[model samples]
Target: MTTEAVLDIAVQALMVAAKLCAPVLVTALVIGLVVSLVQSMTQVQEVTLSFVPKALGAAIALVVTGHWMISTIVTFTTDLYTRMPALVGH
Candidate 1:
């Protein structure tokens, strides 16, 4: 394959990865911010307080978004497989 084709595939893979990760990352970030604010307000800064909620938020995000994530990845994989012959021949 041409350099540009290879680069395109690489970029697409990166985008898919980022898309899959964004929900969990954003959930963790928002939860962490809220936990930080609460800790600041209450003067109760237990490490687990922040850690647990962010973890739970991430898990919840994964649970909520799991179907979409799987479908996206499956679509990408199917497309890649369908293109494999073309990609390998040249």
Candidate 2:
């Protein structure tokens, strides 16, 4: 409706997106760091070692946090949809 309202919604969307993605991203980052450290210590230079663990960590994070992420997104969407008429000044 108003510029402020639009900006507020945009910011909220971004915040929610970041919140939903944080767990997976953080898990992958940590796993990669650990794998790299291990590689450095052991002199094991296999690329797959780092890649596979990070991928699996991200997947497991998704599995564990999937419901909360979906619920947040659904609630946001539903709230937006419910307010559409008012947002349009109808």
lDDT of 1 by residue, 1-87 (tens): 778879989999999999999999999999999999999999997999999999999999999999999999999999989888898
Q: Going through the candidates in order, what is the number of backbone clashes in each?
A: 0, 0
Cα lDDT for residue 10, candidate 1: 96
- Give one digit per residue, the lDDT tens place, for model 2 in 3-84: 9879988998999999999999999999999999999999999999999999999999999999999999999999889878
lDDT of 2 at 77: 94
Model 1 poorest ten-residue lDDT run: 81-90
- Compute the lDDT of residue 63 as modeled in candidate 2: 99
Q: How big is the positional error of residue 58 in model 1, measured in Å on the Cα after superposition?
A: 0.9
Q: Model 2: clashing residue pairs?
A: none
Candidate 2 matches the true fold with a TM-score of 0.95
